[model samples]
Target: MNKILLYFLLFVGIQSFSQELNCNLVINAQQTGNENFQVFTTLEKQLTEFVNNTTWTNKVFKPQERINCSMVITITNKSGDLYNGSIQVQSTRPVFGSTYSTPVYNVNDKNFSFRYQEFQNMVFNPNQFQSNLISVIAFHVYMILGVDADTFALKGGEAYFQQARTIVNYSQQEGFSGWKLEDGLQTRFALIETIQSQTYKEYRQVLYDYHREGMDQMYEDVKTAKKNVADAIIELEPMNNRRPNSYLMRTFFDAKADEIEQVFSDGPSVEITKLTSVLNKIAPIHAGKWRSIKF
Candidate 1:
């Protein structure tokens, strides 16, 4: 090919090479009493490759455009090669006009049970019923995308959410613990469905407002942005009364407790008091912080 054509192709190749995720994957097996230390170390390296090497979506990404996220997998037990553990997955997105990135998804799944062998190839097939490990990891990967996308646009992550739903659907065939609604409120099923549910339409908008309209504006103007954020927090008040610690409410506060506290601490007293009252009712676990919101 001509030099110009070759360079153009190289540019496209490089751009397309950037995966959608800039994930920091950590696998901890300190609690896996029976597994060999080398086995755990190899598994951690294998998992890092499985996560970082795979391209989770069709979107072409610039290296800098890749979403920033972290997955820390803690292996708590091992019976032969079968493992039981917890995986904490969290992702953050940049505020439109600032260098600051804010958390979009922060969840620690306790029911993350799976099987693994040292150096066994880790593969993920979204449409097929797969091992619990691959399915759970892929579920969170898509969710990180879905959550971040929703912040950029109103329900913009529909396709990503559907992909996550697909994983959950196929996971049902595997009969995994966290894939079903009966598994618990904190299961993977509840998180995806709640975001996709028409019954809680305002939930996604609240996400969008908090990130796009609120955080995006913070760099340019803090006063107006804080009001927008407070307004966004109030949007959840009605849902809080209806659902009263529903799946979404809990996850929302889980990812946002610290950020919310800081955002309202600087606003006008009246607005801060009103927003804190609403926040205090919804996320009472952070009652101390919410209650302490002051001018």
Candidate 2:
């Protein structure tokens, strides 16, 4: 009996140690002339600490049980931009395992200086500002072409995005100003705006292709899938509002939620199919100003 117990303990220890998340994370970092991507020595250490020490288990991730994350950074000194790179992560559980890998083939160069400056200013204390930026960048990559919500939310959302927002807002008050949103808004604002990928429109076509190729469609029910897509779109609108849009697309919503639900009908794919037909017969006129402010 004692021998059996000892063996069981060994098995558990092996499993725990083997439960590592591994992947390559490449940063498309570059610099101009003499300056280059200089990851603060501390920042590099903190990232290592996060992966090696955190309890990123099944509770933090659903549909999978363990996670392995790895990264490689490429810094170009002449251009001060991220030319290209990639990251890969995997998760495993007792009976299941999954992996996610993304290519940073394109890096939005909207805020090169500000971004690098932020990284330069970072220290080794695990401050909220530094932590959030890391998360924001990771989230951006995931948003651009990420297919796994479960992994993203579990791995980065709470630890980074939610906390990052607080840090960003705090950096703007009576005592702060260096971290400005304007400089990075073009590429970075998507997180704030919550825009869903426009790729969702291809759902039906993807379904047809899967059928043609003899692959299984994850959602067998069309209506249910549509509803889910709609919900996802609605969720994106609040975040999307932080960015500027075309004129016509800008007039409908009084609040972010209203804009998402009413104008877009909580679905990103539902384009305005009958805008001309709906407005053709009526002459546009401004309404009278409210005689009194009435709620």
Candidate 3:
């Protein structure tokens, strides 16, 4: 009897140790604009509702007491344009410490969920930073839009621009790190400036001509190709449903397209490439350095 009682006491002690304080965390719905406010308020409200109203783990301990928990909520208003969401009470309490461990989970970007290939043609037309991500963007657009590539292309224009602008702004601020927007922008800027620096201005003329005349056909061809790509991807959707999130079929198709396009791989003029290379070399120093220049 004493042994059983001892075991019971130990079980009760463990239960007591694990007992969580039930607390109400209220976040003003209007405070959604404030970054900190958004995160914390959403967390508290969602977690409270999740824990208090419903039972998560069905297996109960000997004494049948609720587990003690601590929660934190965070809200970021700056990111409100991109995401509006709440963090649920994301924690589990063992018979232990007071500190609540917050495991972070990312919100899925709407861009990622959309047809990416169609999204690309719209953003990359001017060959800006958005052009740098043409391949990946095309792949995503194809995957998400599936059969509705043309419709997705038409509707996704604004979203593609917004997302592209965001990425470009961020990369520029961060100094063109890695293969992101900053690097692409810097490369384009160097190419343009090198042409502009010449005494003859032939390079500049070529660029102007390329922009005005050459780009129209290029745009039409690329757009048409993208539409075809979208159609191809839509055909692959049944395969995705079969495999779920597998890009193998889409990638194979894209690779084939790229191989075909490689026929036009002959690059810009030797003089232009040389001057651009020089500009890019010195670009690092001039990237962040700004002095008042008289126009």
lDDT against the true structure, per candidate, is 0.78, 0.30, 0.28
Pitting candidate 1 against candidate 3, the one with the higher lDDT is 1
Name the candidate, 1 or 3, with the larger TM-score value: 1
Error of 1 at 56 (Å): 1.2
Count of backbone collisions in candidate 2: 19
Model 3: C-alpha RMSD to truth? 25.9
- Per-residue lDDT tens digits for candidate 3, residues 1-295, read 1221122111212232222224344433344555354444444454456435432222343333433333232332334223232222222222111121111111121111111221123332322344323322322222222211112122322333333334334334323232242343223222222222333233223222322222212323433332332233234334434543222322222223232122122222112233223222322232221111111
lDDT of 2 at 253: 19
lDDT of 2 by residue, 1-295 (tens): 1221122121111121223334334444433233233543443554555444444333343222233334544344423322222222222212111121111122332332223332344332223344333443433333322212222222222333333344445434422222354544333343333322343222222222322211111123333333332343333233334433412122211111221122223222333323212221111121111111111
Deviation from native of the Cα of residue 202 in model 1, angstroms: 1.5
TM-score rank, highest first?
Answer: 1, 2, 3
Candidate 1 backbone collisions, by pair = none
Best by lDDT: 1
> Which RMSD values do the candidates have, in order?
8.2, 16.4, 25.9
Q: Report the alpha-carbon TM-score of model 2 versus the true structure.
A: 0.35
Model 1 spans > 4 angstroms off: 1-19, 34-36, 267-270
Residue 163 miss distance in model 2 (angstroms):
0.4
